[model samples]
Target: MALQNEKNNRYLLRDWKPENPTFWENKGKHIARRNLWISVSCLLLAFCVWMLFSAVTVNLNKIGFNFTTDQLFL
Candidate 1:
């Protein structure tokens, strides 16, 4: 059965075939490596932001917020 394509004009099926040798060697490898680095950088940045929150909350006592050490642990 023939299926109608999506509205974006791209194929909808998963009939993928990476048969072209040069296309695989050049374009596909570059795109894959760049995407991997982008993912790693995003993960590191998220961890850094999380550490910032930890530092600020630890010093909450210095700001005279009336939160005891036990309360902060909660």
Candidate 2:
């Protein structure tokens, strides 16, 4: 048996049987959905950060930075 860290409410699950329809209907679906949303949220956050940098770089000239190509690349 796996020992759970009760103080943190973290479980070391000994087994996972999400393939069982009863389990899937009751718990697996919720777990799966939560994981999917978490992944999507992370992807969106990453994309936003990437776009922010791209936008900043594109507007450097318009903002009158007077930076060289090598400087901007830095």
Candidate 3:
């Protein structure tokens, strides 16, 4: 039935209509903001991991690892 379909699709966003102020105010805005926060958090985590690796690489030579300049740049 139509009512059952509506219930099932409630969380799917298949019927998204952000142009409709009512829909945006009620649902679309929340979903968009949540996705934005999740994306930002993922990017921040990736940058932190990259910084950790860079710090470790810079210390390798000082720790007597003897990596060549080219090898360390890799």
Candidate 4:
């Protein structure tokens, strides 16, 4: 299967440098800022997710279980 391998192969970009110097200098900076903000928002959103466990764990500890390292991790 050389033919099969070629068909299944994915071209991976290990080196990625955007072209268009003027775009990078001027327009690209604004676009890059927008993308950066979007990325940060996504990251913060992801962290906000699954935080219910923290609140629930705190409530549970108030009832009985203490906020042990295990509870914090869980």
What's the TM-score of each model vs. the native?
A: 0.58, 0.66, 0.76, 0.44
Task: Compute the lDDT of residue 68 as modeled in candidate 2.
Answer: 83
Question: What is candidate 1's CA lDDT for residue 60?
Answer: 88
Q: Which residue pairs come into collision in candidate 2?
A: none
Residue-by-residue lDDT tens digits, candidate 3, 29-74 = 9999988999999999999999999999989999889999899997
* lDDT score for residue 2 of model 1: 39
lDDT of each: 0.73, 0.79, 0.90, 0.69
Query: Where does the lowest 10-residue lDDT sum fall in candidate 2?
Result: 1-10
lDDT of candidate 4 over 1-74, digit per residue (tens):
98787777654323334597865676667666777999999988877775766677668867877678775675
lDDT of 2 by residue, 34-56 (tens): 88999999999999999999889
Error of 1 at 15 (Å): 8.3
Q: Which candidate do you rate higher for lDDT, 3 or 4? A: 3
| Stronger candidate by lDDT (2 vs 3) | 3
**Model 1 ranges off by over 4 Å:** 1-24
Ranking by TM-score: 3, 2, 1, 4
Residue 41's C-alpha lDDT in candidate 2?
100
lDDT of 1 by residue, 1-74 (tens): 23344544442433333477777586656666777999999999999999998898899889878787788777
The alpha-carbon lDDT assigned to residue 72 of candidate 4 equals 68
For each candidate in turn, give its C-alpha RMSD to the true structure in angstroms.
5.2, 3.8, 4.8, 6.1
